[model samples]
Target chain A: MRLADLGERSGVPLATVKYYLREGLLPPGRRVNATQAEYDESHLRRLRLVRAMIQVGRIPVATVREVLAHVDDDSLGLTVRLGAALWALPHPAGEAPGAPAEAAGPSREAADDPHRAAADLLVDELLARLGWSAARELGALSPAHRALVATLATLHRLGYPLDADDLLPYARTMEQAAAHDLDRMEQLPTPREQTEYAVASAALFEPVLLNLRRLAQCEESNRRYGL
Target chain B: MRLADLGERSGVPLATVKYYLREGLLPPGRRVNATQAEYDESHLRRLRLVRAMIQVGRIPVATVREVLAHVDDDSLGLTVRLGAALWALPHPAGEAPGAPAEAAGPSREAADDPHRAAADLLVDELLARLGWSAARELGALSPAHRALVATLATLHRLGYPLDADDLLPYARTMEQAAAHDLDRMEQLPTPREQTEYAVASAALFEPVLLNLRRLAQCEESNRRYGL
Candidate 1:
């Protein structure tokens, strides 16, 4: 297939495909002649994935490149690839990734940023309670860990107290979701595909969970406050 | 407290506090003299909430204005206030809110956007399965409804298969979250405070849930593919 057809079949515009290729986000096609090139199924898949990362995941192109690197690196183990993929995305309003490993006094984040210090403590307690090995190994390097820390810190900063007991339900139920998500990913034939599924789930299905939570919150409010 | 104190305590800058007042994101402080005004505890809380909506929620100022309007309207019932608050947040990529209520072929969203149409069906199925009252009343007008529809549409457009069964666990677990959230809100003394809590939850706590899911997904991957 030609570049135009690859763009059309993937539902990305021609100029955008050219931009991606120029930016090294997409690989070069097979040269068909002096003026044209042919793309295959893998090119089509890559184009769609890039578009979703940018448009749906709302990840910057640079971060998309970082995440794709993890997906494409076959030397990494399956769990490791998925861990790196999750780590690759940016954490919103959290302490910078790979920062503040030392848990004691005078750490820059602890000294300069109390929210992060408090968040770190909460994340430590949550992980300790759950005893998840991947997150334990990845620790502060994982964007997921930082994001959780940051959010808990946000709630606390706003005067909403969230103890480990308050968060146990969320942690336990998310384990169920994680198990379901992994059960599906493990059934896939390739390790790369499994990592891809994890990445896609992060972008695509998360909104589903969030919206459902919002919808259910409406129900609970009605049950409590209808008069 | 004076305007300066309000700004200092909220950690919002004096200029930004003035901007909020100018933009009507904050109410006018009590006029103490020709040049200055006094603020109160409510002003402090409102300032914090507005800052959280903008900084933590990443909501645009215009949408914050819209949501604040709902929170300030005491004439509305408690559940009604929550429903309106949820409705006021932006749906990332769904159909225009308040569009395509008919569910018939001639609706503009149905005619023009198959994703919105497909999303409508999925939301209907999920709501019917749960039989939630507020969502049932609000229907397509709700931002939660539109966001769910939009996200499902995104997954489908990206060629991911998500059945109602795939989404059931998310909906059910979110009900547990919603119940916990609402129980907390119900204990607050004021209806207005309850709505404020709902708005805050939508912004602040959602990240915690999402990151936990990501952390758990890593654990699942490790359990299966550790080598």
Candidate 2:
């Protein structure tokens, strides 16, 4: 298929498809002549995946490129690919205090950024206490750690006063959910299929979890407020 | 305190605070003279919340205004206030196939958007079958509905072939998590505290849920690859 047909068939705009090509998000089609190139089914598949990550998953282009590179690299093992995807994706407050939503209050800078250190320590203690060894195994500053630390910092600044005990249950709940997801993915027959399933779970079905939480929140609010 | 002091105490930049003021995210400070105005602790708190929503939560300014308006409107009940926060947040893929992530292939336009309608019906049936009555109460096109439908469409386009049965476990998991969150929030004594907690959950801690999922994915991948 020509570039135009790739755009038409994929339902992605021609300009957007060209942009992806320029960004190296979508690999260039086979060079048919001086001015024209041809795309194939593989390009179509890649295009859909790129669109899914950028458009649906709301991942930035750089991150998308990193993640796709990992997904396409057969030299890396499945776990490495998975880690690559996890690392490439954005976290809630990984940037922390500078970002407003998760920023620590004035108290954060008090006494040599004690709040930051305490938040970090608290997360370590919480994980150790909860026995989430897999997460701990990733080291102290992994994406999960960054995310957890940021949440703890934000909670403290917000006056919630959460401790390790408060977080253990949530961690356990997520562990169980992840276990369930992995159990399902394990049944797939091929590594490629499994990787695709993992990517799909991360990219597409993630909203199911978040949306369900919102639904549950709505339900609870209704129960409490009788709305 | 004056606006400068308000900005200082909140640790938000004076210019950004002023922006929030002009944007109606922060209520006007009390006028003290022709050129001066007095602010109070409430203003500081509101500023922090506004910052949290915009910076950490990544909510649009317009949505923040709508949410804050609900939070401040005493005429509204607790349920209404809760609904207000939920309503103001963005859905994962509320725009659907129109967005690239879930664009249906050649089959999408064959029968005048049947894929969309089918996806909607599948979500509705899934909720009903799973007995997620609380979500159902929000009607057919709630944020949760929009999110779920978009996810369904994306999964279909991605060739995942999911149905309600496949999603039941995930919905159940989130329901359990929500129940836990609400149970904790209910421990707070006043509606103000509860509302603050609710907003924090929706904004900051929500990342905890997402990040934990990533952690779980990494762990599962490690296990699969024997890493």
The top-ranked prediction according to lDDT is 1
Could you tell me the lDDT of residue A39 within candidate 1? 93
Per residue, candidate 2 scores C-alpha lDDT tens digits across A1-227 of 99999988887889989999999999888898999988898788788778877776777899888877777777877777667766767665523346443232323453455555677677778768866667777654466666666666665664445777777777777777777777887898766556656776776666777777788778766765686
lDDT of 1: 0.76
Query: Who wins the TM-score comparison?
Result: 1
Q: What is the lDDT, from 0 to 100, of the residue B206 in candidate 1?
A: 73
Question: For model 1, how big is the CA root-mean-square deviation?
Answer: 4.4
> In DockQ terms, which candidate is top?
1
Question: Individual DockQ of the candidates?
Answer: 0.51, 0.44
Candidate by candidate, in order, the iRMS in Å equals 3.3, 2.7
**Per-residue alpha-carbon lDDT of model 2 for B97-212, expressed as tens digits?**
46443322322442455555667677778779867666776654466666667667665655456777777777777777777888888897767657766776777777677777
